[model samples]
Target: AQSVTQLDSHVSVSEGTPVLLRCNYSSSYSPSLFWYVQHPNKGLQLLLKYTSAATLVKGINGFEAEFKKSETSFHLTKPSAHMSDAAEYFCVVSDGSTDKLIFGTGTRLQVFP
Candidate 1:
């Protein structure tokens, strides 16, 4: 089976501080991993993706994630957190079957000044 679990449902961070959102996944075969960010009332934008090519993947908005097969984790991180970074993020996984993507419930990022 393939699934994704976001460790935190909500994360609070100060402006300009580093941000970290944890995620874990399980898959039967080599899987494709993705991070997506969604602003209020807006569609999801692809932050980054891991397709069995690279372990360290970089995305938009100064975000990045490392795919660790042994740990079964793909945690996202950023050096500086911005007010605009305050939004919902979803860790996604592809079952290696089709284009269908399974999304985690979501993690709300709250940025405080």
Candidate 2:
């Protein structure tokens, strides 16, 4: 079975400051990982993904995550954050063999000026 744990339930950042959301994963097999973001009343959006190709995966809106097998981590990071970046972030894990996905509790980002 594959699972993911979002270390932080909420994260707050000032505009223009860096943002970091921590996540740890456990998988029986090589897992496919993803970071999804959802704004208030908006649908989920794919921020980035890791599919065993590269350790460092880049995605839309200047967000990126690095797969660290040694650390069992896939932490999301951005050099700077914007007000628009505030949202609920989820860390998802898939076994790559099934459609089933395990999602973390999510981390809500609050961006303030």
Candidate 3:
């Protein structure tokens, strides 16, 4: 079984401040983790992914995440926040057994001016 947990249901940040979104997971096999962003009234967009190759992965719009196997965590971060960054983020895991993504409870990011 593969499962994911996003630590925050909502995160509020100033436009110029930093952003952090925490996530944890458990999987029976080596899992492929992903971070996806959904803008208001928009479809999900792939932000980043962590396979077996790299522990640190960078995504668009200055977003990045570090995959920690020891902690079973993949936390998303950004150096600074933008008004356009306001969106719903999801943490996902896939082990290939079912070829389906196990999505975590989404974390909505609210960016303030």
Candidate 4:
């Protein structure tokens, strides 16, 4: 079974500081990974994705993730965080057999002024 684990349950950053949300995944075969963010009362928005094409994948809102097959990690990072960046982030992996998504517990990002 494929699974994803979010290393941090909570991450706090300043409005202009760098943000790092760690994630690790386990799969029997090549996996499709994704990062999704959800703001208060908002739906899950796709941040970035990796599907065997490129190792480094960039997404919207200055967010990006590098797929490291050797380490089995797909950590999300941003050069700087904004006040609007405060939200919940999820690390998801696709199950090869059923094409179902396996989501992480989630990491809450709090951006302080």
Using TM-score, give the best candidate's number: 2
- lDDT string for model 2 (7-103, tens) is 9999999999999999999999999999999999999899999999989999999999999999999999999999999999999999879879899
- Candidate 3 vs candidate 4: the TM-score winner is 3
TM-score of each: 0.97, 0.98, 0.97, 0.97
lDDT of 2 at 19: 98
Candidate 3 pairs with clashing backbones: none
Candidate 2 has a TM-score of: 0.98
lDDT of 1 by residue, 1-113 (tens): 78999999999999999999999998988999999999999999999999998899999989999999999999999999999999999999997798689888889999999
TM-score: which is higher, 1 or 2?
2
Scored by CA lDDT, what does every candidate get?
0.95, 0.96, 0.96, 0.94
Task: Report the C-alpha lDDT of model 3 over 1-113, residue by residue, as the tens digit.
Answer: 78999999999999999999999999999999999999988999999999888899999999999999999999999999999999999999999778699999999999999
Model 3, residue 73: displacement in angstroms? 0.3
Candidate 2 or 4, higher TM-score? Answer: 2
Root-mean-square deviation per candidate: 0.8, 0.6, 0.7, 0.8
- lDDT by residue (1-113, candidate 4, tens digit) is 78899999999999999999999999998899999999999999999999999899999999999999889999999999999999999999985568489999999999999
